[model samples]
Each structure stands twice: as C-alpha cells, then as structure tokens.
Target: MKKVIKIAGILFVLLLCAAYFLPAVQSYSHIPGEIYILKGSSKTIDLGLPVKADVDSSGVVNISGETLEKGALMQSPLVIKPLNYGKATIELSIFGIPVKTVRVNVTESLTVIPGGQSIGVALDTRGALVVGITGVQVSDGKVENPAREAGMLPGDVIIRANGIEIQNAKQLMKIINETQGTLALKLDRNGRTIDIFVNPVHDPSDGKMRLGVWVRDNTAGVGTLTFIIPDTRQYGGLGHAITDLDTGSVLSVREGEIYFSEVIQINKGESGIPGEIKGFFSNSSGHMGNIEKNTEFGIYGKVFDDVDLSAFGEPIQVASRDEIKTGPAQILSTVDNEGVKAFSCQILRLNDQREPEQKGIVLQITDKELLEKTGGIIQGMSGSPIIQNGKLVGAVTHVFVNDPSKGYGLYADFMLGMLD
Candidate 1:
C-alpha cells in the first residue's frame, strides 16, 4: 500500500512539471529579440512562465515582476516602464537559468493623420524594362536575337546606351534603330550594373534595325492612402512595393504621382479566388501628391497644397509594435463612392518581429457591411489604415488566397521610418 502511494505521488509531480514547461517553451519561441517603447510609458509582457526579468540599466527602464515557485500553477506578468530616452536590455530567466535577452529602445512618440482616400498611382521607372526577347528576321531570311545573345535578361533595366542615358522605351528604340555599329549598353540587373554590347539586326518585316526586345517604361494603378504627416505635409500609401506582373521584379521608380481617384466597381472575393476594386482618375487635374521614394514597406511623398484634408480628421498617435494587441480593431477604407468609412475587424495574431517586416499582423474582417460589400480585403485597398484604441497601428497589405476574408498587415512604424 505504501509503494502504491509513492508511485502515485511521483506521477502527480511529473504532471505538474509538464504543465509548467509546456507553456514556457511555447511562449519563449514567440518573444521578439527587440522591442520599442515610448518614453514615460510602460509595456506589460506575459510570457506564460514563472520567470524572473532583470534590466541592465535601471535609469533607462524599470522592470518589475515576481518569479513564482517552480511548477507553480500561475505565471507572473512583467511590467517594463521606460523612464528616459535611451536603450536597455532585459534578460529573462527560469530558476536562475538565463533563457532570453531582449533589447529595448525608448523613443519619442509620433503622430499622423490616418488616410483612407482613394488615390491613383503613376510610376515611371528609372529606365526601360525589358519584358521579352524575340528573334528578328534579318534581310537574308535568317533569324537572330541580339538581346538574348548579348546576355540581356527579360528583367534587365536598360539605363544607358552608347554613353547616352535611356529614359523610356521610345528613346531606346530610336537609338537602337539609328545606330550604325555595335551598341554599348549599361543595364541594371537585380540592383547590379553590368555592361554589354549587342549588334543591331535589320529586320525584313519592318525594314528597321531592331534589338528584338520588348520593353516597358511606366505603370499605373490605384491604391488607398495610408497616412499623412501633418507637420511635414508628407504621406505614405500602398503598404508594399509595386512589382511588374510580367517579370515579378520591383519597379525602380524615377518619378511618380498620386492623384485623386474614385471607385466605380467592386469584384467580391471568394474562397480560392481574389477580387479587385476598379477605380478611375484623371491625371490632368486631380494631381494630389508627388512620390519621392518606393520601398518594400510603402511609398512616401509630399502631399500637394490643393489636397483637401478636412475628411481626414485630426492626427492621431502612432503605436509601436509592442503596443499592438490581438483584439478588436477598426480599418478605414473606401469601397465605393461613399468616401472613407470605418469598418470593424479583429486582429487575430501579432508576429513578434525584431526588425521591420511586412505581414506582421493577421486580421479578419468582422464587419458585416464590409464583408457584404467587397467580400473582405481586395485590390486597391492595400494601404487602408488600421486603428486600435484610437491610434494608427498598421496598414493592410495582402489578402489570403485560400480565405479572402482574412489578410495581413504592415506595421505603421515601418512605413513611418521610410518617410525620410
């Protein structure tokens, strides 16, 4: 009878240890390597473990929490309060065994006006983009591909030819058709520059000298504006970079513009299929802003004086990654001619990203009206502003192909960093 009681006690202790360690391991995996905190504010972090936290610099940040007993049923939550504008390190340990160290940065707070105005984007690439390479029928009935033979790929950007800068497809075509000898071309291939020489062939079909390459110089699309910094008159939009549909390469922007646009039609999304919003804009009169930079995070530029800012309301505080929570939120978007409207949504998950990244937050459309109208996040809504606790938190970036009602978002901090 005593042996049986001893065995049962051992089993109970083992079960307790399993309960404590399982959640600890899962929580440790989701902890970010670094986090940003606003000065004079505090951040609460729950790792779901009985762990102790220690800060390297007490002047920069204060860490307060209690480490529970081993195999304890309850876990303690740590509160990290930022005291000044500086950096600190917090080390977490379980029973005196160091597990993870997180770098903390306390910075000044920032504010911006959340934007949901539909805008048309027109981008002109730095150089002509090669879309295709074909054979040219020469006068002797022989076929030759000068572009392919010269080591030029379909995605290569022709920046210069014969020491002259090439701006567009028309300019490059004129130079190739009028050149007498082998032409020296400077190409930008995947961000690297290379020099190549190609001899133009005289095609019998059109009686013109040709390189047998199809190129494109510009692209146009519509997207929602994300935010505007009222102090600097700068704005950001399209929480992601624009890429070529044919080559799948990011277009190198030389100059671009954002114009006022109005949505005219909507193709609702469904399972296994994506949808889009059709909009129209005129470049001659509705010019609202000029694009200065196009990065993976978003596009940033200065808003024009002619733009109307009354509908955007007042500027709101921007939330850091640590401040975002998994709960109910709202998003501003324009699906029809009704202008911008706020819709209810839920933040399903938040990724603990140590560095700037896209798709940091998973969101689902919970608003019945929004779901009924556009069937969740569709095209032309890439930069719809996400609001939580009355603050601008992030922007919508991508929609899940398998589930159209769900989508991913980019943090507003990443977009704000690119404004400079």
Candidate 2:
C-alpha cells in the first residue's frame, strides 16, 4: 500500500509540473503557453497631474495537472505595476520564472509641436502663455515740453518708469504712483529700442509722481494688409486714426510698428451695438515701411524682417484693378492664426480713380468664414489687407453698423502715396 501511494504522489507532482509548462488557459482558446498583454494607446499627461492609469493585464494562468488541468499558483494583476508619464516598465515573475517584462509609457505629458512651427500661432509646451514685449510706450509728452527738455520726445513711448518694467498703461501708472523719486523713462525711438532717463514731477493736487508726458506702449492692433505694389512690394491699408473710443483724441503714432495680431475675442452685434474683433498685438513688428498720410489709406513700410515664406511672401496676382468688380473677395488678417482667412462679400463699388483717402475699391463680405470669425469688420481688423479677383485691392476701415461686412476700403494707391 505504501509503495502504491508513493507512486501516485510522484505522478501527481509530475503532472502539475507539466501543466505549468502548458499555455495560459482560456474557455475556447487554442494557444495556451503564450503570454498575452492588454493595453491602451498612449495618452497625454497634462502639467501638474499625478500618474495612474489602467493597463488590463488581468488574465488567469492554468497549469497542467495530473488528473486534470488546474489553476496556476497565481494570476496576473497580482504583479504590482508602477505608472509614469512617457514609458513605464514593469517586471513580474510567472510560475517562479523571471519571464514577463511589461512596458508602459506616460503619454499624458506630451505636446507635439511641429518641428519648425511658428510661435505666432502656437503657445509654449506648458501653454497659458503671453506674448512678451521687448519694449513699449506708456505715456506721451508735448513737443519741446518739460518732458522733452528732460530728453523725452513727444513720440517717446515709455518702456519703463522708475526702474520697473512697464507692461501696460495701468501698470505704468501704478509704478509712477509708488515711486517717490525722479522717474526715469526708457524709450523706443524710430525703430531703435532704447532706455531714456527722465525724472517725474510731483502733482501737487494728487500728490503723485507724474511724468506730465502722455506715455503709450508700442501701438499694436489689427490692421488689414491692403494691396502689394506690383514692383514695390509695399502694402497699404486703413488711412484713418484708430482711437480708443473712450478717449476721443487720436491714438498717438509714438510707436510706429505693426504686429501680427489675431482676432481671438469678439463682441457680438446686437440691435443697437455691433460686434467687434478683440485681439492683442505683441512686440513682433513686421516691415516698418511707410505710414500713409491718407487717413482712408494704408502706409507703406519695409518689413523689418524679410518674409520669404509663401504665406507672407509672393503676392497673389489679380487682374487689372478694373477687372475687379462687385463680387466675392477675401480678407487677410491675423485674428486667429495670423494667416489669411477668406470671407465672401460683394464689391459694393470698385472705383479705379478713388479719392486720396478712398481706397480704389470697396467690398462686402458674403462668405461665411468672415461672418463667423469677425462678425464683419471690427476695430482691430481696420488695416487688414483685402484681396479681390486675385489682386491686392485695399483694406477694411469702417463697418456699416447696419451691414457689418459691408464696410469701406481705401484705394491701394492712396496707401502707396505715403511711401517715398
């Protein structure tokens, strides 16, 4: 009896060992011994997030047994897994053998910016970014005034006041109020960004350190690109002044520069009030060609930096200004990506011999893209260049409150008139 029992025990142990070599068991599965892994696609890990994700490595291992196949010593998911962002590796022992190696990646922490992507459209990897200004004007002063005597010019846009960075108008005021000494001014003159020192005089009534000069940051707003001259390559647009509706006075040209601004925000049109394109401009200045004198036209200036890219270079051809009729046209402005977005509109009037301030042509939006994005012409898009019948025609200046898209344009020549 003892010998018989010993033989049975030996047989059972051998059978169990055989099952361990057999594949993982499944209800109606053919393959057994192969190790299987269940995983999902990699995910992005946003900033400030802790790591934890589901990798379904949940399966049972069946071992070959003497009398019948039986459950293995352990199943998966029993192995502890560590989670990371990009790629994670986990190790586990299967059936007392160091066999399976699992790899997982943390995808949640990635932002794939195209190789040569331009920051004019994209935010940083961490996102939530603001365009930095190299310099800007905060206040203005009268010509040959006390501020001027202190070396401050009328067009001197203040970059800093009292040794503090001047971001915007409000912040400039805050610094001026806090500083109780002679305030120094930093400025950008005629494309040369420089710091100019000046002291502020105390305002007796307000008891504040005040630089009597009216200061302004660099002028940044949306302006349409009018037509690109055939041989000159100079462009033109809005001829009038863009003033902060609040202050009736004209906005100073202290900082004579243009930037690529986008129409990010919008105030919809209503019964009485109309919609507008709300955008912000940065320190990135394009060609500082010419500022047109015709309020109805655009100025021509040489771009400070050369744009060889197709998006900004190589003017698209349009037949004679005469060929352009009252029909569809596209407006190129940077309210979104700083690239040209087309909007359909009717050519209200195409005047070849337009007035000094009147653009050679006039058009209205009939396309859906402009309507959806800008709700017709808004403030910032005033100098946006207009393209019609393949030729650079003019820029949008004013919007017909009644028909927002149906605004006026300054003739391309009028803008060119400002250039030497």
Candidate 3:
C-alpha cells in the first residue's frame, strides 16, 4: 500500500508540472507574434526557449527560405532574410508540442531622417478641459462649488456650455456669465457624452458670474524630434502624448504647430527630481511643421520647407522590436549649442509588448559627459532616437524619477506604424 502511495505521489507531481506548462504553451501559441521588416533585410527572432521552428511561406514573399538552428536544445533564434515583399508564417514547437506562431511581413524598405533637435509644440485642444472644480463666493459670504454639485469631475471635457459649443476657456466663461438660470452643460467623459445642469453663482470677489471650474484650452512645451519621412515631409515626435499635468488626461488636439526651439539652459536631473531643457520659441522663427494627430504614441505632423535636416545626416532604417537587443546603445539628443549629439547608453531590458506603448526599452545613461551635464535622461528629451547596432531601435520617452540614470523608451517601429 505504501509503495502504491509513492507511485501516486510521483504521478501527481508530474500532473502538476504538465498542468502549468501546457496552458502556458497553448496560450502563448495563440498570442499572435508579428514582425515587420523591409525587403533585403534580415532579422533574428529569439524564441526565448528551446524549440523546433518551421517557416511556411505564403509564396507571396521572396526569400531564400528561412534558416533555423535545430539541436537537442534549439536555443538560437530563427533567422529570416526577406529578398522581396511578401508574408510568411513561422511556427515553433517544443518537443513536438506546438508552441507559437509568428507572422512575418516583408515590405519595401523605408528610410527616414532622424531628428534630435529640440522643438517647441503648441497645441489647441478640441474643447476646454475641466481640469478642476473649486468654490465660488456667492452673493453672501458663503462659497459653493457649482460644478461639483452638478456631478462634474476633473478630466471631464466641457464640449458645450449652455447652447453654444465651447471652444476655449474664455468662450465657455462668456456663455456661462451670459446665462442666469441653471446652465446646460454638455461634457465628454472618456468618449461618452454626458449632459448636466449647473446654476451659476455670482462671485462677489470678482463681481462676475462664475461656475468655479478650471478649464484649459491650449498647451505648449518643448520636445525632441523623432523622425521625418523625406518623401512626404511628414514627421513624428515626443514618442508620447501631451497630457495635462493636473488631471493627467491626454488633451484632444484641435490644431497644433511645431516650431524650432533654442535650448538655452539645462536643469540637471537628480534623484526624485526630473530635469528639463529650457528652450525659447519665438513667433518670428519659422514654423517647422503642422501637427495633425495627437496619439498616445506621440504627435504626428507635416513638415514645411524651413525645417533643417542636414545636421542629422542620412536616413536610417527603423528597427523592429525583434531586432532590438540588450547591449550597448546610444541616444541622439541636444544638450547645448553643439546641436544633436550622440550620447552613450546601455539597453538593459526589452519588453515584448504587442501593443503601442512608451516603455518598450529600458536604458541607463553610461556616458560620462551626459551624466555629468544632465545627471541622466532629462525632460524635453522625449523623441530622442535610440540607435543600436547601427540602426534606429527606439526613442527616449520617460525617465525614472527615482533613478535618474534610468529611463524608458518606445520602439522606433511603433512610431513608424503610427505615421500611416
């Protein structure tokens, strides 16, 4: 009986192992992996495990066929070289168990001139954003919050005030002051349209009518340029959206412009405090581009003629996420009067993100000059190109406030995908 019990226990342990590994393998197999590459380019894809992988081409793609390393433990990546534009499927199996399938897309080579210069961005929001709600002094000494009573919250966008559409803060206030009864308010919250009514109170301090809500119409800041498609003269920058500081809501873009900015000072970053590059933008200066889309990935715009790209040299191919490796890397960023300069950094981690995000690559500043001057990645450095293995891999997006030397980056391919 004891011997029988020992055998059962062994079987139970094996069952437990299979229970965990099987689901993981099955789920990962359906996750859908995709790689985008230019024709005549070869990219190595690491499976992160030992597997026997096979490439099945749809015949639409022109290739010498897929070259894979097979062994008792196939630890190496499956190297694929696309000779022409086409599509293919890469299937992997672990000990005869199907593991995962990767979709390969080969397209025409795209070259873009990378921009690292600091540029000033001025954006007009779609409508006035309700950033905050405060108390308004009524006729007597009592103060009341009208917006709060109407169930309005921060991050809610005021689409229309009363019967007129609200374009800016001034316009919203004008309509509110002109009405005396419960003002009809139309709000947009996370894409849903909501309507509420708020009674305006007379602010005795200002001698004007008020709703006690703080609204913002426009936002301006400085950021590094990412890349420019020379053919269309279209550009992308910031590798992230321009979000409101107080409510942390991404501002809707009604209209915007990108202008050349001159970096005058650098506020060095340190632990717990992020630094910034103070740049001055004068209206007299030529506008670089007109912003068209403001997305979570970054801002997209079309460039005019006045923008300069001679300093950045020739265009470089954008590297896909699978091509990104953890090793030595450098970033092109502007620090002083020298314009955009390459600074040494180390790629520490790479996240296998399947969606658009700003934290695809983790890096640390290793250059002595950059560390001494800026302490690490500073503000206004977003959209700085991250070059690795002589290719544009990603862009600097955010800095770790606690660890000034470390920061996050967005994959260059992600930004390129957004342009279309």
Candidate 4:
C-alpha cells in the first residue's frame, strides 16, 4: 500500500508539471501569421525556446544576432526591430527546426493628429431601414398592416417608392401620402433586391397615408474624434461600426456630417448598467467634416476647413499590435465642454488578432477625474484616441456592461488601414 501511494503521488506531480508546460509550449508555437511593424520600431516576442531570427529582406529588418547565432535566449523573448520601410519574413527556428514564419511588414511612419473633441455624427442611411410593422387604423376604423401583407419584414431597406428612388423616410412618406392607389416599393432584403406592392391606408387619426411600418432614414449621436490625417485632411472616429438602436445591424451610410458638440450630462455607470455621456449638437456653424464610409472600424471622411485641429497639438505615429504592451497608457477624450483632456489608463489585455477587430486591447480607466465624473468609460466616449509610449495605439470602443471601468479598444493599425 505504501508503494502504491508513492507511485500515485509521483504520477500526480508529473501530470501537474505537464499541464503547466504543455500549454505554454503549445501557445508559444501559435505565433501571429502576420505582424505589422512601423519603421524604426521594435517588437518583443517570447516563444519559450531559443529562436533564430532569419530576416529574408535584410534591408527592411535587423535581427539581434548573426545568421549562424545560436538563437534568442532559451527562455527569454526575442526582440525584432524594424529598420526601414518594406516587407520581409522573419523565420523563427529552434535548433534549425523551423517552428514559425512571421510575415513582417515594415510600413511607413504613419502619423495622425489625435482628436478628442466631441463631434456630433449625423448619418443618413442609403435607404430607410424597416424596424417594425404594426397595424394602422383606417378611416373606417379597420386596422391593416399593408407592409406585412406584402411580405415586408423588419431589417428590410426600402430603396425606391413609386418608381422614384427613396433616399429618406420623409420622401417615402410623401409619396405614400400622395399616391392615389397601390404603391410599388423596391426593397433590399438581406442583399436580395425585390419589389413589393402595398396599398396605403388613410388613417382616421391624422388623415395621412400609413404603411404601418416603422422606418428610419437618419441617425444622430455624439462620439470623440479619433484622428485626422494631416496630408489628406481626412479623419476617422467611433472605432466600432454604428449599429442601429433597434435591430443592432450596422447602418449602411449614404452620407453623413460631423458637427461640434458639448457634453451636457453624464450617467454614472455601475455593474450591469452601462453609462452614457449626453451631448447636444451645436447648430452654430460648426460643420466639421463629411462622412463617406461606414465600416466595422468606424466612419471615415473628409474634413472641412472650418474644423480647428490646433487643439490636437502635434501628430503622433501609429503603433502596430506587435508594439502594444499590457501596461500604462493614456486616452484623449472630451467628457465636457472643456475640450480634449488626456486621461491615464492601463492596458490590461492584448488579443492576438490577425484580422481587424475592435477589441484588440482591453484597458481600465485609472484617471481620477474621469472616474469621478463618468465612473469609467461612458457612451459618447467612443473614438477617444489611445496613446501608449508616445504612440497612437488604438481608439476606445465598447464598455463592458459588467465593468464600466474596463472597455475594448481597436488597434490604430486597423483604423489607419481603412483610410484607403
């Protein structure tokens, strides 16, 4: 019995050791397929083993050692620094065994003037978005849902009405009100364009023609400006896409505008209840820019001459994900009418994202003023520029509902890639 017990204890110890070391080696084996490195920047990667850095293009990259050096440290991280602007491949090997191949893209030193001023985003959808369909009361007191009868469903985009292109909800309403009989609607249902016929009902309550469908053509909200490219006079904001309030679908933007805004109130955040920063758009000739694209990485467009970028100070070079570390950082956000202020934050987590994702970095608000006022990140704080080590690393995105102090951020590399 003593022998058996001793053997069991030995086996348990071996299993525990394997459990700790196996996953670490497995995770280390899984390096990013592609890594973006800015010119003259360095990235450190720990693979849990000695690695020989072999750069295909010597002109673009500089390895730590010679071609026949043993490797990076057995347990230490490998430091790969970019020397010039070009593409190269860094082959990492352990004792001549190729373990991983990283496509190193040494890009130009891209810089942007960080923006924190709150800008009112007024987006006009390409077509009216159908949110819901309900029964409409006619003159005879009969309730009818014409849109539903025509197979029209929520999430459908109405593009045309009575052979005319419908740009907004008001235009669709006007045609319906003036139509003598049945109306033809060209709709885009999940990208399948089709036409549907529905007869409008004259409501007794207001004597207006009704389709019994709730549709919206425009949306407006406030968000912090992320950056403005000096050479292009273009800017981007709201690291994540602008989703509809009802259906939660990404809105397809036709055209939009940015206006100057000021925060009026702040709803303190708590666990499970997200907070918001309410602001009013200024109609005082503060037209700042025009939005042209609405992508998963936010909105991008041209800026007007009236927009004052002097408040942003100087342009900062962007940082790739390879350069982001889990440590101290700061975010530029406008929580009030006082303009942009830098708030300290800590990067708690960094995700391995080969593709574009909004939650590339997780950060916690550590600024006393921001915490005291908003209780962490709030709505309208999206697009706040995240700076780390004097580089623009990302932009603030969604706040965690269970922890308002923590929120997601999009890597600046992803946002800058969308400019073209």
Among these predictions, the greatest lDDT belongs to 1
Ranking of models by TM-score? 1, 3, 4, 2
Q: Model 1 residue 137 lDDT?
A: 88
lDDT of 3 by residue, 1-420 (tens): 999999999999999988867764665553438777777667665454556666566443422353442223345555667755777777777878777777888887677888888999999998899888899878777989989999999999988877687788888888888897989999989888999999989888777888888989999999999888888898999999999999999899889999888999999999999999999896875689999988888999899876666655789877766668899999999889788899999999998887777698999999999999999999999999999877888899999999889999999878888886
Task: Name the lDDT value of residue 46 in candidate 4.
Answer: 68
Candidate 2 per-residue lDDT, tens place, 1-420, comes to 999999999999999976754443221132121121222222221211111222333222111111112213333223322232233333334434444444432222111100111111111111001122222223343222336546654444455566665566677778767766666666654345666555555554556555555544433355555544444545444445543332232333423544455456777554345676665545553433334332324334433335533345454543323335677777665556545555566777866463365545667777676677656766656666566665655566677777676678765435545666
Clashes of each: 0, 68, 0, 0
- Against the true structure, candidate 1 reaches a TM-score of 0.86
Answer with 1 or 4, whichever has the higher TM-score: 1
Candidate 2 Cα errors over 4 Å, as ranges? 1-219, 227-233, 244-252, 284-296, 317-321, 351-354, 359-362
The residue ranges of model 4 lying beyond 4 angstroms of the native Cα positions read 1-33, 39-98
Q: How accurate is candidate 1 locally (lDDT)?
A: 0.87
Off by over 4 Å in 3: 1-35, 40-88, 94-96, 308-312
The C-alpha local distance difference test score for the whole of candidate 4 amounts to 0.85
Q: What is each predicted model's overall lDDT from 0 to 1?
A: 0.87, 0.46, 0.84, 0.85
**Winner by TM-score between candidate 3 and candidate 1:** 1
Winner on TM-score (3 vs 4): 3
